[model samples]
Target: MGFDQYHEPPNELPDEVRTFARMILSLIEEAQAIDWYEQRMAVEKDKEAKAIMRNAQKEEFKHFGMDLEFLLRRKPQWREILQGILFQDGDIVEHGEEAEEAVD
Candidate 1:
């Protein structure tokens, strides 16, 4: 829902970890925008809207992929830690736990 819902308790993570989580959340926000644009393009037959959605979707994918790769390559441990924190209680947790174990 809101940013606060995504955040873990402050005591659970260091400043750096918190910052990285925020960065990932920002990427998610951008991704959501891309999705919104795509949906709008699908519903509307406007030429300009379609073009804008296409460009935005491509850019969003590029940015999202780059950010994910950066997290996986640069700070892998932190990435794993962040995943655990983000997904611990969600429906994704079971699948995520498998992925987390593989990373470990």
Candidate 2:
């Protein structure tokens, strides 16, 4: 499709960099799909339509998670930071600050 993901010349980018850019774009698209489905479900009148939208949104959520996991695997520092921040009980901002400090 479009090569809008590349800020620099795509021809100059290594294959890995190009692949990373593609994954980033996929992550963004998945997030946008989730948001669109949320808005659509909110105003939808038909029960069946809302149910379908909800299902589609769940699929988008899974895709988003997969994309995030893939990117995180490529960035160990990011993974380390998120480990301290995700799924733990505490002040979120505090957790984020602690995670950032830990990484640093």
**Candidate number with greatest TM-score:** 2
Assess every candidate by TM-score: 0.59, 0.95
Pairs of residues at least 3 apart in sequence or in different chains that clash in candidate 2: none
Q: Kindly report which residue pairs in candidate 1 clash with one another.
A: none
lDDT of each: 0.73, 0.96
**What is the Cα root-mean-square deviation between model 1 and the actual structure?**
7.5
Q: Give the lDDT of residue 75 in candidate 2.
A: 91
**What is the C-alpha lDDT profile of model 2 across 1-104, one tens digit per residue?**
34888999998899999999999999999999999999999999999999999999999999999999999999999999999999999799999999999999
Q: Model 2: C-alpha RMSD to truth?
A: 1.3
Error of 2 at 62 (Å): 0.8
Model 2 TM-score on a 0 to 1 scale: 0.95
Give one digit per residue, the lDDT tens place, for model 1 in 30-67. Answer: 78877887788789788887897788888888888777
